[model samples]
Target: MVAIHLTSSFLLIRHFIPFMKKKGWGRIVNISSINGLIAMPGKAPYCFMKHALIGLTKAVALETAENGITCNAVCPAYVETELVMKQIRDRANQNNISYEEMRVAALVGFLCSDEAGSVTGCAIPVDAGYTAR
Candidate 1:
């Protein structure tokens, strides 16, 4: 997960940086997971990948900020998207909770806004305070 996701994002950004630099304004949001913020049992690969993504976001943001570019990561513990519904559902079942309770979508929305123009190099969590523990 770390190698694939990390390398792919780097490659994609490498190909696009020139264009965004030319425009003097850009925003790059990497959709990372709360695993990036903390650890859990039997989730080493995921945690490693997400942690790398946060590092990448910060590193890239620093390198690009001078050109009006902002790079950040949004760390979500669970969301009701089809992409990971099964995983969230399984977790919810194990925890004796409802999957519906995990459908969060905030950090992404915030980081994508014009008001977040100066909020670069951050891995803001959208995990319903999960990482606060």
Candidate 2:
């Protein structure tokens, strides 16, 4: 549980933050999930990690913002990736929504760009309106 979700982000930030600090331009995009903001039934571990990831992103954002670094998170719901289709095709189909894969990349790309210089600690959703409810 800790290794894949929690520890990995922590370690990556710890390892590379200094380099970014040295360069004076850094962007951190943590890929959270809709479950992080809204819980999903029977997906306790996944939800927990994503929720934790949100906290991590927020803290990291505050810690590094003044250093010309920005940390934001992309929260996508049921993106049409191979892993999602393979694992949750039945449930996703039950939701009656078509695939929305590009949204995730689009949000991440915006967060990484210079235009979003002041946008940090945000859990931007790319969920095809799933979280709108």
Candidate 3:
């Protein structure tokens, strides 16, 4: 999955750079997760993959800067999406807790704070400041 994501992004950038250069402006935003920034127990693969995405974004941003192209990754924590619900369910099962309890705990642990918008090439933890504490 990581390979596919990275390869497709690279191919797209390669194909689009000429057009962007001609137009002299372009922005590429990659959606990453807070998990990409901080490692969580039992989620080694996710942590590894997200960190790789950040690295890829940084490398691409540097390579494309001269061409008026900017590549950035937006890291959001525990948004109220289906994916979050799935994670809640998984955690509930793994920890033998109620779904509601798991949900609240997850939110409290990972999604309770404002994001730092000024940081780049840095993991923006939208997980409610989970890393802050």
**Compared with the true structure, what per-residue lDDT tens digits does model 2 show for residues 29-130?**
998889889997899999999999999999999999988899998887756677777544555466665444434677788889999999999988776567
Writing each residue's lDDT as its tens digit, candidate 3 over 1-133 gives: 7666466766776788789789866666665677677788998887777778888778877876776666666566554577578875665677576666533333233322223222233344443345676
Estimated TM-score for each candidate: 0.80, 0.84, 0.63
- Cα-based lDDT for every prediction: 0.82, 0.84, 0.61
What's the lDDT for residue 43 in model 2?
93
After superposing candidate 2, which stretches have Cα over 4 Å from the reference? 86-102
lDDT of 3 at 122: 39
Pairs of residues clashing in candidate 1: none
The true-versus-predicted C-alpha distance at residue 11 of model 2, in Å, is: 0.5
Report the poorest 10 consecutive residues by lDDT, candidate 2: 94-103
Q: What is the lDDT of residue 39 in candidate 2?
A: 94
- Estimate the Cα RMSD of every predicted model relative to the unseen true structure: 3.4, 2.8, 7.8
lDDT by residue (39-110, candidate 1, tens digit) is 999999888988998999999999999998899988878756789889888877776776665554555667
**Residue 42 lDDT in candidate 2:** 98
